[model samples]
Target: MQEDSPLTEATSDSRGASLLTSREPSPSDHSGRGTSRRSKITRKSHRKSRAGCVNCKSRRIKCDEGKPSCANCKRRQVRCEYPANPATSAAASGLVDPREPGDLPISEIELTYHWATTTCHSFSAWPAGVARVQALTEEVAMKNQHVLHLIFAFTALHLAVCRPKRKEHYTTTADYHYERALALVTPEIASLSPDNCDAVLQSVQMICFVSWARGPQAGEYLAFGKHGRSDWLVMFRGIRTTLASLSRDHFSKTHGPNTRGKGRLLPPSDGPFEYEKQLMELKEHIEFVSEPADRDDNVNSVEVLQEMYSNRYGGKDGEYHVAFGWLYRMSEDFLDRLQRCDPLPLIIYAHFVVLMHDLEKFWYMKGWTHHVMSGIYEALPIEHKAYISWPMARVGWIAP
Candidate 1:
């Protein structure tokens, strides 16, 4: 048999939809379960007409009205999304009008164009190597269909955040590309090769960006909630695992298996830190508010924060993933307390949210800091609320 390219396009599926969370495959799950549900995607039959998918009309482009994907979107290198009950919606909404297509302020082509130039840089936190990562991502994406689709997907998501009135349209567009890429890429994750390693690793990050940029999940904030670690963390943990699977000749060496579990001091910084004082105050309040049994656990949690907060990342503008180092190193017991909405952990997590706010300038991190901070404030008791004054005031979080 001749060799098959990894760039094979995904066929439209008639099978029932599944949640993205449920579809994420664990490394130990060699069953290839993620691809099983997608097995029923039969060939799609297109109904040609003047009208096309929702994205075409939204972008004011001339769509050829193909099912699953249109000629215009495919040619422009952007996501394709057909309306549900496409014929019915097209007929009812009168989406098609007889006129020449016009240019847009931010066209779909522009969105795709930004991916290599702008979106890819967000993956690397270090300023010195952003261009290198972006170049690698684009180079890999060109030969890999899965990586290309996710690149476009993330760009569409960024565009959605930029335009709130058209948020739903762009978000749906992003999901369409993301779902397709994920379906095709899931099985290949376990059996990575030299050729596909970088592409697959890049796709994993695209998955994280798509998940996080969608805004806060209802119950999940910063990977802690009633159900332990959120799905986001579940997916993100793969970055290191995948790196371990590969040689790491080029990928940034930041995410290697973190054995920094506990009892290690961070690289010391020279100066009086405000966060150190905040931690001291937090420890003081834990004495006042915690029950005898709970007090010890709460103190353990703060001590973990003390280690995380004791240093600065490259002096002020923190590294990209610096904020999340605490979450990765936190004990399972403390995570349980967070899931239970324990006041002390919530307050401590709020301080971490301040670090998360350091990345607030990024489009994905823009509103997340305030959102997580608000969740903490709401979860905290009135007495403990005072401890988060700095975080609350820092993020300008207003109570509902």
Candidate 2:
């Protein structure tokens, strides 16, 4: 509830009496009347204090006594404090720090709540609401929690797109939540091997998104206590290790073929082995393309990359089409350059070049890529020739 102002009421009365007081008063009397009116107005104006959440009030150096906590406290994930008699308590406890006039007073409780509510509160709230609906077992409750954790982790992943600096804190929270989520999901996985299914898929996706969104964090987390990009590389390397483990137990049940009661299926002799080899090829190619390069390759040049991007593969018909279908759009030459370029440096440089409009320097150093590719196009097979040239011809119009 808002407090009424004593000064406002007193001011109205003073205004009403102004005409009477002005009627031929003695000079001394007039001065005394003026002083009295001023003092009364000051006291009325100063009466009753403003209250806010401890966090907000401390930040504002005002009393906060509203909804257990103030808006700022809630937003910042800080603790909120509500003293019994806020005004009296503030004065007695010297809550107001004179030295740092700008400092806000936020209680620990308010901060914690602020962080929870602002960040993962919505996600965490889901498990609680879900647990009560169907008499959930501890295992089931944990699974629900896992879903909530995935939700929170992805939420953090999305946030990383905009708030890159907060990646570390968000990552920490996400992984801790992930472990709990994994505990819930693992039993289901163990029981139903390959059919480990949706919950597992989501958890894996969350891990992938988190790693992709904040690559640096993946590096740090996987390293135990070690530092650097090798750990980051492990993000992919580790995928293989995981697959190796999965293959040992669940490969046959989940995949085609039943080797039950037969001889053991060795790595290279099995179909799954071949599939894994193909997967590894793709993984290796990705790692290679994304690796750092000291100089610009043909793929890195804007004109050549743009040509590669504009080219599309046709289906069975001999129509105008580019290969790899629509899904592989980024798989084009320009993207290849990005894939080949050291993502860390290239992304930063791209941002700078974009911000500064350094197209002149960009083209000057890389423009000849088109000329080089023109010769390579001539050597292509007849079918490939048409696809390459048409896209190349249109490159002038499609300025990068």
Per-prediction TM-score: 0.62, 0.26
lDDT of 2 by residue, 1-400 (tens): 0012111122255322211111111111001111224643543222112434434444565432334444554555433444344344454444532212333333212222332334322221133332221121111223344544544454554444445686555554455445556677667545544544433434443454344344333213221212332332333433333444454455433222222122121112111212233323433433455434522432233322233223311112111112112212222333333334333223212211211111112211123223323323433444434333323433331222
Which has the greatest TM-score? 1
What TM-score does prediction 2 earn? 0.26
Q: Write the per-residue lDDT of candidate 1 for residues 1-400, one digit (tens) a residue.
A: 0012111222233321111111111111011122223467854444333356656787776666653456877665555555445444443344542112441223334555566446756755543455445555555565566776677688888878777777766777687778779877897797787656767777887788788888887767765654566777767767767877767664444322332222223234433356677778888988788888778877777776676554443353234465566776666677777877887788878877766775666778777877777777777889778878887776678777
Q: After superposition, how far is residue 77 of candidate 2 from its true place, in Å?
A: 2.1
Name the weakest run of 10 consecutive residues (lDDT summed) in model 1. Answer: 21-30
Model 2 poorest 10 in a row by lDDT? 22-31
Against the correct fold, how does model 1 do in TM-score?
0.62
lDDT of model 2 at residue 157?
Answer: 46
Q: Positional deviation of 169 in candidate 1, in angstroms?
A: 4.0
Q: Candidate 1: deviation at residue 252, Å?
A: 9.7
